[model samples]
Target: MQFSIAFPLAALTLLISTITAQAPGSQCGGIGWPGIMFCNPGSVCSKINDCEGLHGSLADQM
Candidate 1:
């Protein structure tokens, strides 16, 4: 039916618009949203707390 084609067309348009309308990214250590571009290369987007080293550390040499 027409419903099937219309549904897929609408979904495709929405997906394309969302992808194309993305905003620019910020640099490393810059203040950005958690889900957004919050960091850059050679850096991470982690909470700077006392237990920072315990999170991203290696557990085993495997």
Candidate 2:
């Protein structure tokens, strides 16, 4: 059915978009870092030693 094909295609598109859009382990909040920061779903930005960054497993990793 058209629904079946559409569902999988939509899911694939979403996954690819998520991967390309988010920078899971990249730097987030810290001194001398002037930029907006964000983490992927199911995680939060936290301090990692001297610089703040995202510290959580990504969806693809799980």
Candidate 3:
């Protein structure tokens, strides 16, 4: 029983993590934006100044 529960829990965690990973050039954060803020591997969240406010963009690795 414990094994059955643990397997589902682990799968859910992995699914959630993948869902939150943002691709390069994707928006990760900004004022009033309620979404994932983590960038995928080889990318970093960067601030982009716009008229509204500071937004986040996934910058590719240098």
Candidate 4:
């Protein structure tokens, strides 16, 4: 019984990690003109260089 629980838990952890391992650009964040912008959750615009108020212009435009 313990082995069965451990197996499923391990499998679920692996699956979750795998799904989240994809590029951050794959999810919604911001726009970077030439490329997709990505930021951590709850991150401020100031944290990203090409994000609106951060750099004035998109990275691709610069």
Candidate 5:
């Protein structure tokens, strides 16, 4: 019984660590833009476009 519990716990820990390590976003899904604030999901703006006209500016601070 103890062996079974330990094995499952170890597996769960490994899985959690793996997921956290691979998680996205350093800030706001990694979409922080300069002079802009947020990026829209499912928008068709390329990086060459400078992420402008694709997202709204930050409120009260832009």
Candidate 6:
């Protein structure tokens, strides 16, 4: 069987943008991509930039 990375990449990119875009204090970040999530107005979101160190997969992040 053959697999295409483009699809997964695209999905990740989409999730990174959509999920991260929150209106309030939402649990954003930790998608194994590093520096993707964000916080809303008067909210705080901790950004973890060392996902590779934990040695995990994309789903594992969630």
**Which candidate has the highest lDDT of all?**
2
True lDDT of residue 13, candidate 6? 75
Best by TM-score: 3
> Per-residue CA lDDT of candidate 5, range 1-62, in tens?
99989999998876665444321222222234443233333222223243323322234123
lDDT at residue 30 of model 1 (Cα atoms): 30
Give the alpha carbon lDDT tens digit for every residue of 7-52 in model 1.
Answer: 9999887667555332322221233433433222223333454332
RMSD versus native structure for model 6: 12.4
The runs of at least 3 residues in candidate 4 whose Cα sits more than 4 Å from the true structure, single-residue gaps closed, are 22-62
Tens-digit lDDT track for model 3 on 1-62?
A: 99999999998887787677866666777776677766554556666653122223334223
Identify the runs in model 5 with alpha carbons over 4 angstroms from their true place.
Answer: 22-62
- Of models 1 and 6, which has the larger TM-score? 1
Judge candidate 1 at residue 11 and give its lDDT: 89
Better of 2 and 4 by lDDT: 2
Q: How does candidate 2 score on lDDT?
A: 0.64
In angstroms, give how far residue 60 of model 6 lies from its true place: 37
Those runs of model 1 whose alpha carbons end farther than 4 Å from true positions after fitting are 22-62
Listed per candidate, the RMSD to the true structure in angstroms reads 9.9, 7.0, 4.8, 10.2, 12.0, 12.4
Q: Name the regions of candidate 3 deviating beyond 4 angstroms.
A: 1-16, 50-61
Q: Candidate 4 lDDT, tens digit per residue, 13-60? A: 766754544243243333554433433333322335434333222343
lDDT of each: 0.40, 0.64, 0.62, 0.44, 0.40, 0.49
Q: What is the lDDT for 22 in model 6?
A: 51
Query: Tens digit of lDDT per residue, candidate 6, span 1-62?
Result: 13488788888876676565654433355655454344433445545463422222334346
Error of 3 at 2 (Å): 19
What TM-score does candidate 1 get on C-alpha atoms?
0.35
